[model samples]
Target: MEESQEEIKRGLKDVAACETRISHVDPKGQLYYAGYNTDVLVGRVSFAEAVYLTWFDNLPSQKELSDFESSIISEMNLPEAVIKRLKSYSNSNHPMDILQSEIPYLGMHDPDLGDNSDSANRKKAIRIVAKVPTIIANLNRIRNNEPLIPPDDKLDFASNFLYMFLGKYPDELERETINKYMYLHLDHGLAASTFVARSTVSTQSDIYSGITSALGSLKGKFHGGANERVRGMLNEIKNIEDIEAYIQGRLDVKKRIMGFGHRIYQADDPRTKHLRELCENLCRRANKLDLYEKSKEIEFVVLNKKNIRPNVDFYAATILDALGIPVTFSTAFFASGRVAGWIAHIIEELNQRIIMRPTSRYTGKYGREFISIDKR
Candidate 1:
């Protein structure tokens, strides 16, 4: 029995080698990519540059960056079939669900689906990244009964997304806010949904199908649901004065605050600080400093008394609120950024060609006598 137990442990420890490059956490739980710290990257780089780095593994020259932007902008139109399929979903269906269906539909439209060579795969990756924003923006427009605007090649990726979603050019600050938000959400350290994407692709599934599965996983409450909950919590509070009492009441009942905790970073989430700063600047510019102050008050109360730090969703709610992005569309916007990382991982898995299958330990007896359906 001891040897059997040892065998079980060994079976459980069988891990697969995936070639997809992922940044490791240092002792401090800080994430890095290819020798550069995320904090440094966030400070020094535009979101477009970060996405380029994630795909190509190097910073682009000015010309290269310009060409990259132009390439993505050129491919930003979704096929008409995809748009028609998106319209079939009810207006009340979650945007993420619509996204899940739309991604697989994209696979059907991809011309190079049969081409597995590296060059073809790379081009497909670019198309997926470029078109995901268009797909998500179109879904939002359809749900709201608004007219869908085709992508404008003149605008950068983030700017075009803002225009498509809002039907006008975003101001400089709004454009920057969208860019930063997209950049920050591009990837995390192999999150569960990301892992799901990799695992699906590891089975040699197409990239769009893998990402569709990932979108379904992300739609769950524990993953992408926090942002929506944060908006809901803010709505419930309704006024600045009610925040403390409201938070205290929730804590008294041992309820989980929507954006207070994180599974990976036990201290504070590093991503929160940059977004918070952006929110602060935006609020100041908009002459709505009072709202920012109220949010900060809640943050102070939550941190000092309960030892909870606001995660990305807390500040994301504020940033989207300031930019006039509706609460329901926030998670879909998150998907727009994340689809790049998903495509990257999917392509990486296809290159590595490793199957990800884990063994489960059986807790019940292996053999049992068959019984009649009505047996006592």
Candidate 2:
């Protein structure tokens, strides 16, 4: 039945589109993938293993994990043609714009471009996953006038991203840090980007197109850019003393204090716990605990003053900053993790073979008789 506008749920809040075995963000705000708790999976399972779990709904044994990593590394080396094309993009373009625009062209370079078979899509998924980090890293390198670095076959997914972006291997701890970041965000329950990706694939579009759709969805400030905004907020704070001033100032003006709330998590975002710890440790290691100190003050003040909890982006901003990632690329780096979820959802949508079309409540004027130009 067609319902009135008031009956419609804005943003599809509390709506369930389909059942998924891939992952769950339960009512209590706990996150799990393939029945394994996220806390257990992250730091314990490789990002590659996590990807395998998303695809197969089971953890990969060591042998399967090795094979998956091998497949991804072999696909990591982008074609020289793609490299030349990437070099031609204007340095002034936003990294997400460059990333979104490059994906379709990258799809053209794929051998399985039009093949929508499950096996073929999985192959394309692997390639897309492998190349996204490269695309993100190289695009920024071009912008900075730095020579693009190729992927390292010896490194795993996270380490290679650091290598490609930073032009050297991070230490094991640093490498593991990036890996954990990637794994922790591998899949979530039907986020906007995942929905966009799934909807694009429901039309029989290729994996690249699906991911391109997701990148566009993620480019929005609300969905994926919070971490970048958090970094900006931290920068604006400048010192620990300014934390309360900034928070109260925003509150006074009825402006959102970014990273303090979530649509899904009731109190605190589950991901915030690890990222908070990681951010503090990194700050301590670098002897640059000012940002961490400022962030804690902000969180404390916001919670007491507003009763709002900090989401993942709150601490993640400091964590990524502590690890030396530029604020410009923070969201794109977010896309790097989110792409795994996008792929998983795309695969699920295609397998289910349901085209997603929702009804809308139109409130435009009722139909009237049309008049010709010569009507009196």
Candidate 3:
């Protein structure tokens, strides 16, 4: 049967599949998490407090934040078996693939693996958010044949992840940059990865399974890995003078200018404004302002030619590069922050108690008589 085009919602664009209290991207081009504007929350709140707000629907009090932060750091240690497994993998493996595969393996060791109670799920969420940074940092170290650095409990969430990754204490500037990055990435309402997570756990599957599914989804080029591509784009343009010609050439060929535009935001990605400034400051301090300038040129060219604005990933590529993170780990950095939001969506989906089972429209012919294979 042929259905009208109006009946089809490709990509489910603007489709409200379900309700969420965790976050929102409004038509007015602002992002909110639990009624707080993300712009307001990014610099002021610690990433831990932001995580707390996403999961619990409000910001934590001082004592609550302290306890929550401690709980996260305490769980950052990877099991010995997991470390050995990470070592066994080929260094050629992508970080996101390694992270995704290890999550289900980690699930096998969870004491409350079978429990889907609110309390149990919350605990699982903590373990996931905490361990993800450890997994990514260690994977990088293993690939480079360097000793892994353990998480520093004295440092807060963002600070500790930087410490583990860089093998040193981050200065206040670095700490502030990472906290803002993580907070900006903490959640977006029903993002592709978050939706995959919710759909997985909606079947009452384990939280680890839900998270694993989410990691795979986040690895997609159109989603989390766009920053890596943006970085690659930056490398392709060798000089500041070549940005326009390079962008125009790519556009003339109908190639996507990575890190530009968004599906949800018509004006500009609200997250881009903060990241743009952050990238500039980090690059300025690192004496790598050239990278920031090139990024701005690309943004300006794309905006002038296509009328499309830069999304969060555009400036994030420069910021991550300024922080000395390899392009390979870019999406893993995304997972490190987004796993919190995925868990929040998972917990909320569990409460819905309905499996996500959207049906597809079939356009093939029907009621035709079948012929036996021998008849032909």
Best by lDDT: 3
**Worst ten in a row by lDDT for model 1:** 3-12
Model 2 agreement with the true structure over 1-376: per-residue lDDT tens digits: 3535656888999988876888888657689998988977668877888889898888888899889988887787777888888888776667888888888988999989988999998899889999899888887677778988877777887788888887777887778778888887787888888887888888777788889999999877777877789888888887788778888999999998887877787756778788878778888888878778888888899999999888767887887888887888888888888888888888888888878887878776665779998994
Q: How well is each residue in 1-376 modelled by candidate 1, as lDDT tens digits?
A: 2222423545222243355564543434466654567888875676677778877888889999988888888899988888888888887777777777777678878998777777887888889888888877787778778999988877778889989988888888887888888887888756667888988978887777788888887766667767788878877877888988998898899887787776667666777888899999898988877767777888998997789788778888877777777887778877888788777777777878878886555566655889999994
Q: Give the distance in Å from residue 370's predicted Cα in candidate 3 to where it truly belongs.
A: 4.0
**Best TM-score goes to which candidate?**
3
lDDT of each: 0.78, 0.83, 0.91
Q: Candidate 3 at 132: error in angstroms? A: 0.5
Error of 1 at 156 (Å): 1.3
Residue 245 in candidate 2 has what lDDT? 84
Error of 2 at 115 (Å): 0.7
Rank by lDDT, highest first. Answer: 3, 2, 1
Quote the lDDT for 73 in model 1: 86
lDDT of 2: 0.83
How close to the true structure is residue 14 of candidate 1, measured as C-alpha lDDT?
29
Residue pairs in clash, model 2: none
